[model samples]
Target: MADLGLFGPGTVTWRVHAEPILFVGGLRSLYLQALHPRAMAGVAQNSHYKNDPWGRLVRTSIYVATAVYGTTAEAQEAGRRLRALHARMRARDPFTGEVFRIDEPDLLRWVHVAEVESFITTARQAGVPLTDAEVDTYYDEQRRVAELAGLDPATVPASAAEVAAYYESMQPELRVTRDSAEALVFLTAPPVPWKLNPAVRLGLELGGPRLLYLGVASTALGLLPTWARRLYGGFGLPIEGFTAGLSARALRTALAALPSRYVQGPIYQGAMARAAAAQT
Candidate 1:
């Protein structure tokens, strides 16, 4: 069998990506990505995010899982499929009437940085602590995913300092638009599949998903930088570090209590099998 995808056991990428806490990061990434006007436009116009938020989440989760845990061939195939999809997506800026491709280098870089940073930040804040060096390594290792998105790995931020600088320089381009508001609303309580809970349809109908989303999104929002929070001024309460930390720790513990068969999906299990085989 092929070796574990680009990342394997003992790698910082593996350690960070393996945690269930990263789901909070995924929520944070979408919030931050929407703050970029062009990125939001691409998603709002060209993506089915509004109509099928759960499906979109599942697809994105699968892609990330494949990159971190599947074989080299699997990762490459996933990348190819994503690139082909992006190549056909075009969007127009509502403010400037500027036309751009979703695959544009800069746009791809923005989405890439937002996502990996969210993952790393959420992990650190939510109890999966990393040393300073390991944090940098995680950022550096994620450049492979940036490259997979058709971005130049060299242009992707490879260190904590660089990522901060990148965010600072790009702040001028980030703003809250109509799409941003819509994304926030959609993500705050995206429709859960009725099939996922056949027995509790009545409970689901009584705002179960909204209550759950509020908890998840509060942690995610609290993890955002002060500036990003300011951009979302009336959205909700300000989440301080201590509060986010406690919430994250609780979430991690809850997930850890689940059985491995329920928590570790096929991609994770496949990687474990490969690692075990390599050891033998």
Candidate 2:
């Protein structure tokens, strides 16, 4: 096992350097959770690995790692390693008795898109200026991964408009009543744990900012009259009230308290500036 302490500073510093990534990732998780009732069902049906535990854990870990590291070679390496670990888990399907491959395209596509979109959207939200070319490049890379998984590359949307359309088509599959924007919040939150890995463990620890953000948002929504929350929820604006009510002080506190390996101030400031500038 890698020394946890050695990895600690890198992980923490990474958390700071990668806040935009985290934000988008959190939103993506929220979207998937809100959408996929069959998420749990898929695991039970398709997963042959015993208990389907490690597979889910490693997948989430990779997602977190990708978010913190961006879509660079380092992040890809982390994902590759995690994929190997997942492939080692062995179990047979009760019905088909088929063994599962950790690198299955369906699962890989989900991870790839979630991470890519998380990085892109978070950077954009933070105000990072991205050229159309940059956005296209990111989309193309994700599409390549999707193709590798045997999914239609066309199914990977090329623009924001396409993403909106795709989400519309998927509305029936989603569990939440929110619109795409609100659904994004849930899609990118931390994933539910199915198994444990160091990366995932670290992610859970480093998830303080996201958890705080969501908690405040949820509470704010609850405080509104029931009709208001429901109305907004109907429009897919679940946390608008809560986000609006957030104080600068609260946001600062949450940012400061987030567990990260690096000196938080500089990294966070850089990320914030980049976000502001629209540099995804």
Candidate 3:
């Protein structure tokens, strides 16, 4: 029997994640995640994202893809490695002088909700044909992903309403710290890694990729909720939402025109094939 991973092809999680626009969704989640002071502090102190932003992005994308499409055991092993890594890392609170583990339930839950919520929001904004109830199902389907990341599934938000409540309850703990501001600038235009050839570096600095990334960053930033925008020192207007929706749809359409093999990874293709075979 072929393994269909944690979420089979029939699941909303699988169907939604196949969209090319999820790249924007991933960036949107990062913008959302940086709102929590503790989370931002942990990342600033422990993560090399500033120096190796591209590498970190690729690694994160791979992990997410594996969780969505890897076989059950493969997904479990990936989660185990992530948990082991997080368990060994600790961050210090500069203000309180308290040390905390990176794998704390609250922090993990925050990340998970921000991620899944961003994915659904991005899809919706891009004119993807997902109904409201289906959005809730996508959130519920993602609890398995939270469990893989060392979060207790029950602690993770499992519905759109639950996610709204979770964010509302978490507001007291969310704020923009010095690190968050710095991270915003970095994530907007991270320092170019030295590994790229001079031409590629030039492209990143003064060429097409820079303009493309600016679009992605702008769309992601604009798609942020009003409160999150306020935390980041920007007030989002109604026009911002409209413009963001248009940009997201345009970007999605552009990417969607690419060949399926280019947009969807091997794991996703293989999982869908297995799912088709199982049905037959």
Estimated TM-score for each candidate:
0.94, 0.45, 0.96
Estimate candidate 2's alpha-carbon lDDT, on a 0 to 1 scale: 0.45
lDDT string for model 3 (121-198, tens) is 999999999998999999989999999989888878888999999999999888888888888888788777788899
Q: What Cα-based lDDT does every candidate model obtain? A: 0.87, 0.45, 0.89
- Which candidate wins on lDDT? 3
Question: Which residues of candidate 2, in runs, are more than 4 Å off?
Answer: 1-17, 20-24, 43-115, 131-133, 144-155, 176-260, 263-280
Clashes of 1: 0
Worst-scoring 10-residue span by lDDT in model 3: 89-98
Kindly state the number of residue pairs that clash in model 3: 0
Report per-prediction Cα RMSD to one decimal: 2.1, 10.9, 1.2
Ranked by TM-score, the better of candidates 1 and 2 is 1
Tell me the tens digit of each residue's lDDT in model 2 across 114-146: 455555654444444567666655566456445
Error of 1 at 191 (Å): 2.5
Span of ten consecutive residues with least summed lDDT in model 2: 1-10
Model 3 pairs in collision:
none
When sorted by TM-score, best at the front, the candidate numbers are 3, 1, 2
Name the candidate, 1 or 3, with the larger lDDT value: 3
